[model samples]
Each structure stands twice: as C-alpha cells, then as structure tokens.
Target chain A: MGRWKNGILITYLVAIVFPFIFLFLLSMSSGWRFPDLLPEYFGFKNWGKVAGTESGIAQSFLISLVISLSVAVSSTLCGFVISRYVSYHPKKRLLTLLTYFPYILAPVVFGACLSYYFLKMGIFGTTFGVVLAQFIIAFPYALIFFSSFWNEKIKSYEDLVATLGGGSLTTFRKVLLPMARGLLMVCFFQTFLISWFEYGLTSIIGVGKVQTLTIKVFLFIKESNFYYGAMSCCMLIIPPVVMIYINKKYVFNKLI
Target chain B: MFLEVHDIEKSYNKEAIVSELNINLEKHKTLSILGRSGCGKTTMLKMIAGLTPIDQGVIKLDGVRVDEIEASKRNIVYLYQEDLLFPHLSVFENIAFGLRIKKIKDHIVDDRVIEMIENLELQGHGSKMPHQISGGQRQRVAFGRAIITNPALLLLDEPFGSLDAGTRKNMQTLFLRLAKTFNITSLFVTHDLKEAILMGDEIAYMDKGKLKIYKDRSSFINDPETGVLAETEFWKQLKTEQF
Candidate 1:
C-alpha cells in the first residue's frame, strides 16, 4: 500500500513538472516533425531571438508587466480601502452582491458589451483600454478576496488605535497594514496573475493592436508556429512563477 | 470630575441601545460598570472613548468639552476584551506604538518602552511578536500600550475576559497595582460580579440601557438588579450543600 502511494506521488510530481520541462525544450528546438526523434537543431537561437526587436517577445513581456502591475497595485489598494467601507456599510449585503455582477457574465461577453463604450471613448485598441477592461474583472475579485479581512476583531483594532492617540493614517500604517501585510501580498499576487494571463478581455479591448504576452502566445498558436508559441508560453508563465515563489516565501510563510 | 458624561444616547434603527447615560469619575480612579451582555456597557464606553458618537450628550474632561473631539485627539484609550495586539509588531514596538506615532524622540521611546516592559513584568520578551506570548502577557502588553500613552481616560471592555481563572486573578491584582502607580483613570466594564466589585473605585450597574451608580461596594452587593444578591445566594447554597 505504501509503495503504491509513493508511486502515485512520484507520478503526480512528474505530471506537474512535465509541461514546464517540455515548454523549455520546445522553445529551444525547431523542425521536429513526425517520425523524427528530436528537433533538427537544439540551441539558444530561439531564446536569443527573444531579446531582439524582430520577435517582439520582449516588448510583449514589458507591456504585460506594466499592465499587470498597474492592475495589481490599483485593484489591491482600492479593494483594501473600499472593502472596509463595504464591510461596515448599512447596505453591505446589497453592495457586495453588486460586486459579483462583473463575474456574472463571461469575460468575452463582458468585453464585447464594454467594447462600445471603449470605442466611443476612443480608447479601443489602446493598452490603457485593455488595462481598464482587465481591472473591471480583477477589481471585483480583489474586493471579494479582501472581504473576509475586515471582521469584529479588526474593527476593535482600529478603535483601539483611535483610542491610543493614533489617527486613521497612523492606524493603517502602524496596526492595520502590518497586521494585513500577508493578506495584502497574497491579494497582489492573485490580482497580478489575473491580469497577467488575461486574454479574452484583452483581446476585445486591445483590438489586435495592443499585443500583450498572452495575446502574442495566442497569435503564435493560431499561426501554427509551435516554437514561438512555446516560447511565448514560457515568457507568459515567468511572472506568475516568480510571484508564486514570493507569495509562498513572504506571504504564506509569514501568515503561518 | 476628571470625566463627566451627561444624558448620552445611542440607538440603532430607532431602537435605543444606550439611553440617558450619565457618569462622573474623579481623577486617578477607576469606575467599574457591571452588566450582563447587551446591556449597553460597551456602547457607553465607546461613547466616552469617542469611538461611538452620542446622539445626545455632553462629555467634558478636565473642564473642557471632548465630545466634539476625534477619538485620537480626545486623549482617550479603549482596550477590548481581546488583546488585539498588532501581530507583526514585537512586544517593545507594540508598547511603543503610541509614542512613536506621536513622534517622540527615539531614545525617549526606547527608555520608556524598556521601563514599561519591566513594569509589565515582560522582561526579556521585548523582541517577541504578539503571537509568541501567552494570553495573559498579551493582555498585559495591551494595558502597557494604552497606559504608556498617558491618556486622560482609559476604557477597558472586559480586558481579561479571555484569560484562565488563575491568570484572571493575577491580572486583577496587577491592574490594581498599576492603577495606583500610573494614576490611571479608567472605566472597567465587565459582566463578572466579583471583578466589578474588586476593580472599581466606584461601581455602577446597567440594565436594559439604563445605569445606576452605587454609593459603595455594600450598596452594589445589596442591589438585586446588579445580580450580586442572586450570585451570593448561589454561593451560599453551594457552600451549604457541600458542607
């Protein structure tokens, strides 16, 4: 029984790790057709192309980073502050229910519905437009994510700070922020992931002009360029991978 | 009176929670307000702390009106049933939080915090986070944090309610000693009958949003509405049955 369990564990590990290894190898190889055991050549040539302007991978990576950072920081901050009011509001239940309205429809449908306003505002096909669309989805997620953070105990802490001769800003900086550091980092990581790999909303709002890394990956896939697709996929996973590591090390461990 | 509250009122949804609340407390004294749960004890304390706005009242501290002041500016500190320590801060930093926010000199903060740590009997634990300490220690840290600020008033909402019986007894004793040493004026709210009698320089009883201040400990014990008479009978019956 123990041997079978160990075998299952090993299989699970390999299953999860296989895609990452395959993507790395596929990104570095080219011309491996049917009946061929390996690619015609395997080198850093494809990786080398990422730095040059011809591939546009670096540009896509930078754009994705900027969009994700903006979305993450803005959503996390707005969510943290607004969630406090929502938690304390007289109409808290109704307000919270409204936050879920964004998630009620599919992102593509939501994006399509929003495209009209985006076009009217002359922001369609712009990076800012894509960011705004993604934020619409990510913001609610952050709001819901931080809803559980404000409880009776947290309120007591705020009151205690007030009584201790610290104003609202002091309470947030000294007590609330430090108490919520782990949750804030976790929220940032989650929202960053939401914005990083966002596609449908980005596609509709970006209008094929604002090529984020996720869009580039889909573009490569559509053209049937497996090598570039694999490379873009590799690039797309980098931030999330780094974030997962950070969330684990700094956020989760501190939380525990 | 160091603190005076007159005809304070609070309501939720047109229903009264605390009504006609009035209190007068002298300097360097403690007023223990005893009540059962949901008897407006917390509401009254929060109102005094400026945490909850009073629908109708005037509050004066040291001959000046404080009802219009913000909680932080009012120089009042409120302690909850739970310690509510800043989990990310160490014991020293937690105790020194108010002083630091007030922008006291670093050396003064360090000296005062160290002295407070000693007074709290928390020696050698300054570097420890709140989670690293026991419940009684956390409660002590909470008290120290509040007292270190030298507030005009301290409101304690059952500060030791979560402790074990032994720890609770010890805390009660420590609080009495600290009250004298720091010259602290406070409102100590609790549901426990004996704790109310022990902790207060003056005693008041609350029922259904109304408060009646007792003349003395004997008067408080004699009041049936305070539940002391019933509690005494129960103890007497238990003693008789055990004997």
Candidate 2:
C-alpha cells in the first residue's frame, strides 16, 4: 500500500512537472537542431535579453502586473460585497445563477458581444477597458468563491458583532475582514492569475493596444521566436509557482 | 421586570415556530429555556436580541420597547454553542472586542479584560488564539466577551453543549460563578433537562411554539407535565450507582 501510494504520488508529480522541465530547457536553449532530443547549447542569453529594462518583454510584463493587481483588488472587493448580499437575499438562486453565467459562457464570445458597448463607452483600447473586460470573468469567479464562504457560522458571528454594539462598518473591519484575511489573499492571487494569463478578452477588448505578457508570448510565437516565447512562458510560470508556494506556506496555513 | 418579551410571533414558510410567546424576566436573573431541537427556543433568543425579525411582538428592555431598535444598538449578546471565538483574535483581544467597539479608553479596556481573564482562570492563555485553547477555555473566553460589554441582556444558546462531560461541568461551574459575580441578566436556552435546572433561576419549557414557565426550581421539579421529578429521581439513582 505504501509503495502504491508513493508510486501514485510520484507519477502525479512527474505529470505536473514534465511541462515545466521542457519549458525551462526550451527557454535556455540557444542552438538546437530539428529532430534532436537535446539542444546543442544552453545559455542565459534569452533571459538576459528579456530582463533588460528597454525590452518590450519587460514592458509588457509591467503592464500585465499592473492590470492583474488592479483586477485582483477590484474583482475581489466587488465580488465579496455581491456574494455577501447573495448569500442572504431572498432571491439567492437568481443571484447565484447570474454570477455563474459569465464563467459558463466563453470569454471570446462574451468579449465580442461586449465590444460594441466598450467602443460606445470610449473605454476600448484603454487600460480601463482591458481591466474592466478581465473583471467580467474574474469577478464572477470571486463571487462564487466568496458566496460559499459566508456560512451559518459567519452569519452567527456577524450577529454576535452586531449584538456587541458593532455597527456595519465596525463588523466589517473588526470581524469579517480579519476573519477573511487568508481567504481574501487567496482570492486576490487567484483573480490576479485569471487576469494575468487572459488572452482572448484582452485581445478583442484591448483592440491589440493593451499588450499584456500573454500577448507578448503570442507575438513571440507568431514571429517564430520560440526561445523568447518559451522565456515569456517561463516568466508567466514563475509568479504562479511562487504564488502557489506562498499560498501553501503562508496564506492557506492561516485559513481553517 | 428588566426584560419583557410580549406576544412575539415568528414563522417560516407559513409555519409558526413561536407564536404569541411572552416572558418577563427580572433584572440580573437567568431564565433557562428548556426545549428539544426545533422547539423555537433559539428563535425566541434571536427575537430578543433583534437578530431575527419578530412578525408581531414587543421586546421591552428596561421598559423601553427595543424590538424596533437596530441590532447593533440593542446591547443584547447571544452566546452560541461553538464558542465562535474569532480565530484571528487572541483571548484577551476577543474579550476586549466590545469595549474596543465602544471606543473605551485603551488602559480601561486592558484593565477590564485582564480582570475578566483572571475571573475566567485563563490568565496564562490570554495571548493565545481561539484554536489554541481547549473547548472549555474557549467558552470562558466567549462568555467573558459577552459580559465584558455589560450587555442589557445576554442570550446563551447551548453554550456548553459541545463540551465533554468533565469540561461541561467545569464550564457550568464557571458560568454560575461569573453570573453571580457580574449579576448578568441572561436567557439561557438548552435542550438538556438537567442543564436547564442547573442554570436557571426560573425555568421555561417550550413545545410546539408555546412556553410553559415554572416560577421556581421546586415548581419546575415537581411539575408533572415537565417530567422533571422522574428525571430527578433517575439522576439520583445514577448518582447512587443504582442503574
């Protein structure tokens, strides 16, 4: 049983890690021939080039970072508020159905449908437009995550706070927010990742103007610069890996 | 009467949970409500605290009708079964939450909280988080939190229900001691027949949305409808190892 369990775990680890090994090697490979299992040479030149301040890769990354963080904060807060209401509302089923709609619908299809409104609103091709577009998907995800979080226990806690002479604002700041600290951090990172790797919505709503890192990866691949594409993939992979590690080591440890 | 719950009615899905429920409790007196689960005892407690809306009734605290008052301004604390101590808060901080909410002076809050800790016999555990404490200790912290606010009426809903027998006994002793010390006016609801007798100055039994209140412990014990006399005899037998 122990051997079987270890075998299953090892196989699962390998399945997850196999892609990253290929991505890392591909990103560092400088001279590789077709039909060859290994690259002729491996070097840090691609990483060095991308790390430069002047590189478009770096610029696109900064843009992705800003957009992701903004979307994460806005979506989490808005979703949390919406979820709180939905959890207690008489029409909770209706609210929950609405919240899940965007997540169920394809992003590309949704973006296409919303593009006309974006143009009329004069937000298309701007930072606001991209962030707003990404939030459409990110917000619903957060709403669902949070809707399940406010259970009967939390309701009781809220009542306790109110009974203890805590007003709405005081209950939020002193009780709800502190209690939700770990989950909030997790939601933030999850939403950030959603926005970070989003390609379709950014492509259409951004009108090819708001170039995020995922867009950079696409551009690198289009130009047949597979190494640079792999480098972008590596850059993209690093943050999530670090975030998952942090979630495991720090944030989730605090959650019940 | 310091607290009067008059003709309170509550219903869910057109089924009455509590109908025309009336009880008047003196200042600093503990009213133990005995009922089975789903007997509307908890609903009565919630209605009094303004946590649940009363379909029709008046809840008067100090002769002031407070049913219309916002829950925050009601000054009625409800202690739940699980302790529900804020996991993020240290025991000291949890006890001081109400004072902090009232914006009491920092030094005063500290002094009162420390005194509460000593009373709870949790002096060494004050800095620890809720999960770090034992079930009994958590209840003490929760109890301390409720009374530290000097609430007008405290509603305790099976506060010691989840504890082990030994811990439950200790918590019951602690509760009696603290109730005496603080002179707290409380409505304690429990399904446990023995616990009802143990906790209340006066006991009320609920069945099918109606209340049958006993004016004194002797009356409660002797009431044929309550079956308390038989239960008492059984307890006596168990104590004498007659079972």
Candidate 3:
C-alpha cells in the first residue's frame, strides 16, 4: 500500500513538474526552433535580457505587482462586506447571487462588456481600466473563498457574541476578524493570483498600451520572438511561485 | 420580577414549535424546562434569550419590552450544549467578549473578567483556549462568559448535557451555587427529569408544543396524572420502603 501510494505521488509530481521543466529549458535555449529534438545551445542571455536591469522588466513587473495587489485588496474587501451582508441580512440573497453573475459569464463576453463601459467612461486606454477589469474577474474568487470561511463558524460565534452583549460591528472586529485572519489572507493571495494570471480580460481590456507581462509574452510569441517570449513566460511564473511559497510558510497552517 | 415571557408563539413551516408559552421568573431563581426530544424546550429558551424570534409574544426584563430588541441589546445570555466558547480566544478574552462589546473601559473589563475567572475557580485556565480545557471546564467558561455581563436572564440549552455523568452532576451543583451567589435569573433546558428536579425552583413540563408550569416542586412530583412521582419506580419504592 505504501509503495503504491509513493508511486501515485511520484506520478502526480511528474505530471505537474515536467511541463515547467520543459518550459524552463525552452526559455533558456539560445538557438532552438522547430524540427529540433532539443535546443542547439543553452545560455543566460534570454533571461538576462528579459529580467535584467535594462529590459523594462523591472517597470512592467512593478506595474503588474501594483495592479494585481490593488485588485486583490479591493475585491477581497468588497467581497467580505457583501458576503457578510448577505449572510446576516438574509433578504439580500437574490441580490448577492446577481452580483456573482458576472463571474459566471464567459471572460470574453465580460471583457466585451467592460470595454464598452470603459469607452463610455473614458477609461478605455488607462491602467485603471485594466485594474477594474481584473477586479471583476477576481471578485467572485474572493467572494466564494471568504464567504465559505465566514459561513463555516462565524455565524455561530456572532450569535454567541450577540447574546453576550457584543454588538455586530464589535463582534466582527474582535471575534470574527481574528478567527478569520488566516482565511482572509488566503482570499487575498488567491485573488492576487487570479488577477495576476488573468490573460483573457487583461489582454482584451488593455488592448495596445496598458501591457501586462502575460500580454507582452503573448505579443512576443505572436512576433516569433520565442526566446524573449519563453523568458517572459518564466517571468510570469514568478509571482504565483512566490505567492504559493509565502502562503505555505505563513497562511496555510493558520486556517481552520 | 427579573424576567417574564408573555404568550410567546413560534412556528416553523406552519407547524407550531411553541405556542402561547408564558413564564415569570424572580431574581436568583433557577427554572428548568424538562421535556422529551423535539418538545420545543430549546426553542422556548432561545426565544427568551432572543436567539430565536417569537411569533406572537412579548418578553420583558425589568418591565422593558424586549420582544423586538436585538439580541445584543437585550441583556439575556444563552449557553449552548457545546459550550460554544470562542476556540481562538483565551478564557479571559472569551469572558471579556461581552464587556468589550459594551465598550467598557479597559481596566474595568480586565477587572470584571479577572473577578469572574477567580469566582468560577478558573484562575489558572484564563489563558487557555477552549479546546485546551475539559468539557466541564468549558461549560464553566461558557457560564463565566454569559454571567460576566450580569444579564437579567441566563438561558442554558442543555449546557452540561455533553459532559459525563459525574462531571455533569458536579457542574450542576457548581452552577446552582453560582446562580444563588450572583442572584442571577436562570432558565435551564434538559431532557433529564432528575436534572430538572434537582436544579429547578419551578419545573416546566413541555410536551409537543405546550408548556405546563409547576409553581412548586411537590406539585410536580405529587400530581397524579402529570407528576414525575407517578412516573418513577424509585419514588414508589421510596414511598413504600421509607415509611
């Protein structure tokens, strides 16, 4: 039984790890193209060019970080408030479900809708527009994660607190917030990852000027700059990796 | 009068859970609601605690109409079967929850909580989490949390039902002593007839959704049809054997 379990674990690891390893190798190879089994040469030039000091990597990286962080924070906060309202009020169930409808809509369709509104609002060619678009895509993730967390034990605690003469807001701040700290962090990080990796909406809404790393990478691939494109792909993986690491180190154990 | 329940009715899905229930409790008295399962004893206690809505009745504490008041504003505390102490909070913090909610000053809250901990014999356990304590200790903590606010009504929904037999009996005695010392009005719900007899100043027998309140202990044990005395063999044995 143990051997079989170990075998299954190894298989699962290989399934996830092999692709990234292949992608990393492809990104580093200097002279590889189609019809070759492997790359002709492997070097650090591509990585240095894309991620080094002068490649505009630092600027694009900063923009992506700022946009993703803002979207994550705003969406998670909004989701927390909305979920709490729906959970407590009970009459707002229909409205809460309606708020989540945009998340279920296809990304392309929602992107189209956002573009139309952004044009009307004169935010079409701006970073704020991209952030707004990403926020919408990430909102439901935050809502689902935090709502489930809130629903699990917060309701009962709230009732207990209320009976103890703790008003709603005070109970929320002292009891609910402390109990749910770990889950809130998970929601924030989850929202950040979703916003950061969101290519379809970001690409569509960003159009030509407001470029994320994913967009830049896609554009490079289109132009057959596979070397830079692969490097960008590797760069795109950095945020999620760091996020997962931080989550494992800090947030995972604290969650109920 | 410390607490009064006037003609409260509650129903779910068109089925009445409790209908036309009335209770009047004096300060420092312990009233126990005894019933079979699904007899709405818990529901009645919850209504008194403002944890559940009363469909057609009024609850007043010290002559204030509290039927429509929010649970936090109503000065009635409820303790659940599972203790329901905040798992993340230390015992002191859990007991202080109500005080903090009332926006009491920091020193006062500390003083009150410390006093409760000492009175409840929870001196060394103040910093421990709920999960760190035994079942009996947890109930004591829950009681401390509820009573720290000095609520006019303290409702216990089988508060000691989860403990072992010996622990439950010990807690019952401890709780009765605390209730007397603090002059706290209490309504305790239980399925155990002995527990009801042991703890109650007045016994309320509930069946199906109706409540029958007994004004005296002898009346509850001696009445022919509804009496616990008539239903118990030990009472019969004692009646014949002791005489």
Judged by TM-score, which candidate is best?
1
The digit string of per-residue lDDT tens for model 1 on A1-256 reads 9999999999999999999999999999999898999999899899999989988999999999999999999999999989999999989999999999999899999999999999999999998998899999999999999999999989988888888888888888787777788889999999999999899999999999999999999899998889989999999888888988888887788777
lDDT of 3 by residue, A63-129 (tens): 7888899998999888887777765665656756776797677887889878888989988867999
Model 1 chain B: weakest 10-residue lDDT segment is B220-229
In terms of TM-score, which candidate is stronger, 2 or 3? 2
Model 1 residue A250 distance off true place after TM-score fit, in angstroms: 2.3
**Model 1 C-alpha lDDT per residue in residues B1-88, reported as the tens digit of each score:** 8888889989999999999988888999999999999999988888888888889989999989999998889999989998888877
Residue-level lDDT tens digits of model 2 in A1-256: 9999999999999999998888888999966888887887788877888867644788888889999999999999988877999999989999889887886668988999999999999999998999999999999999999987888999989999999999989988998988888879999999999998999999999887998999989988998888888988988887788899999889877663
Q: What TM-score, computed on C-alpha atoms, does each candidate reach?
A: 0.95, 0.89, 0.86
User: Model 1 compared with the native: what TM-score?
Assistant: 0.95
Task: State which docking tier applies to candidate 2.
Answer: medium
**lDDT of each candidate versus the true structure:** 0.92, 0.89, 0.82
Preferred candidate (TM-score higher): 1 or 3: 1
The two-chain DockQ for each candidate, comma-separated, is 0.85, 0.77, 0.65
- In what order do the candidates fall by DockQ, top score first? 1, 2, 3
Model 3 bad stretches (over 4 Å): A1-54, A85-100, A103-105, A150-153, B224-227, B234-243
lDDT ranking, best first: 1, 2, 3
lDDT string for model 2 (B1-243, tens) is: 999888889999999999979899999999998888988988888888888899998999999999999899988898899888888889999999999999999999999999999999997998898879887888899999999999888999998889999999998899899999999999989888889999999999899889988877888778876778888788899989964
Worst 10 residues of 2 chain B by lDDT: B218-227
